[model samples]
Target: MAVRTPVKFYYDILSPYAWFGFEALCRYKKPWDLDLQLKPMNLGIIMKESGNTPPGMNPSKGSMLARDVQRVSEMMDLPYNPLEHFAKTVFIRGSLTTLKTLAACQIMYPDRLEEMTRQSWLGLYSRDIDITDKGNIIQFATAANIPDVDQLLAFSLGNEARQQLITNTNEAVESKCFGAPWFTVTNPKTGRREKFFGSDRIEMLGWVLGKEYVGHHPPQ
Candidate 1:
């Protein structure tokens, strides 16, 4: 039997591009024989530490970003409401609490991490719901049917989850990450690690992993 390639996906729920990248990877997981590890990190810290200014800070760049997001969403067949939802919701609720919760799920509910992350992104980007709200966090946890919702919530709100998020963010900064949806893929054939950035780079990933370059919307 062939060994599955290890792919670490570093993401933050605050990034719509991360959502696109995450969905793309999830779609290719089985076809590419990938062992996908979801690494939840703080994108704000990455931008800050890397000295990279977010494009959304500039009005023209922000407008271009909205158009790009719409185009990408259409191309990927992924659901995204609008940049308005992003500016209104994410800026208000912030990224830390939501990411810490995801970090907690990564630790205690590894199996459910993917679904939980999807639900979180959908809540924020699709439905314009704040995933960082205390009640909404519990709601998402309950909906995912993660065992012991109370404990998970507590852990998310506690120091351990905070530390985990900090660690993940620090690692991402050390890796020279300037944005979300950062990928660190271990080539199965050569035992070498390769880094990929952005949702459009999956073909490069396929090349490194010795896999076919399936379309973004490969038939299920």
Candidate 2:
């Protein structure tokens, strides 16, 4: 029997690239014999501690990133209808509520984190919904049909969720993570842990795992 590779996927839903990366990793998980770990972290804290400035912070980079996000979505064939005045509203307002919900899910519904993440991504990217709002967060959670949702909702709004987000963010920073969609893949045989950054690194991750690099868009 082949040994399964352990992959720790650290993501922040605020990033379109992280959404794409999460999908790509999920698509390849079984084929690559992976033990995928979904880790939700606070990108704001990661950026602050890692001394990394968001591309959106710069006017030119922000414009380029917006276009790049569209192109990547097209390449991956993912839905990405961003909210109006996304730069001013979504970016400025941040995704604390959504992140807290994901963190709470991590604690309460570990098995459902991926589904919740997918729904959260769709809420922000596909539906153009502001997940930062408490109402929207609850709405999305209930829509996802998560188990113990009321308790989950309360947990997300409490101190437990805040601390979990902080702890996850701190772990990412400790791993030298400067951005979201960061991955730490541990080779079971060699006992080596490798860190990878960005959605573009999916191909390289396949190479590292000794799996076929079938490009970004795999057949549906």
Candidate 3:
């Protein structure tokens, strides 16, 4: 019998690349028989602690990264819609709501976590809806067959839920995470742990898992 590989995926919704990476990872999950562990984090805290700056903090790098994102998405035929402006404060509150709801779903609608993650990404990027919007939050949760979205949202708004995200973010930083779309792959058999950064490394991840996969690699 083959071992089911466990992958810990850490991400922050503030990044468009994280959205791209998450979707691609999900698309590949079944084929890999992966046990995906999703962990949402605060990118700002990770950057500050890790002494890393946002890719776009430098105008030149920002332009290059913007192109890189567009190029990768177009080449891979992935979704590319992005929010016009960065959510100043709306991001923290909104993401906390989603993250807490995700925790709640783990108890009741475990199977729906993937769809909820995807919908959260769509709300910010594709749908032009801010995830901080309560209506959208309920809509996404309910769509995922969540039994009581109203209660989940109410719970997420509490101090406990907010602190949970902070704790998660702190844990991520401790793991040497400096950015979104970070992954820690653990081979169940050998118990080997490996860290990888970026959506661009998906090909490498497949190679490491010894899975027969294509399209993750760039053309030579």
Local accuracy by lDDT, each model: 0.86, 0.85, 0.73
The reply for model 3, stretches above 4 Å from the true place, is 87-94, 106-108, 187-190, 216-220
Local accuracy of candidate 3 as per-residue lDDT tens digits, 1-220: 5556788888876677887788778777777877887877777788899999888777888779767877877776766765566545333343655676665554446678778777877777667676767788888886777777777777776766667667778878878998888988865446788788888777778878877666653322
Give, for candidate 2, the lowest lDDT window spanning 10 residues: 82-91
Model 1 clash number: 0
lDDT, candidate 2, 132-194, per-residue tens: 777787777777778777899889989998999888888789999999789998755576888
Worst 10 residues of 3 by lDDT: 86-95
- For model 1, residues 57-97, the per-residue Cα lDDT tens digits are 88888879988998999998888987455666666667788
Stretches off by above 4 angstroms in model 2 are 217-220
What TM-score quantifies how close candidate 2 is to the native fold? 0.92
- Model 3 clash tally, residue pairs: 0
Each model's TM-score, in the order given? 0.94, 0.92, 0.85
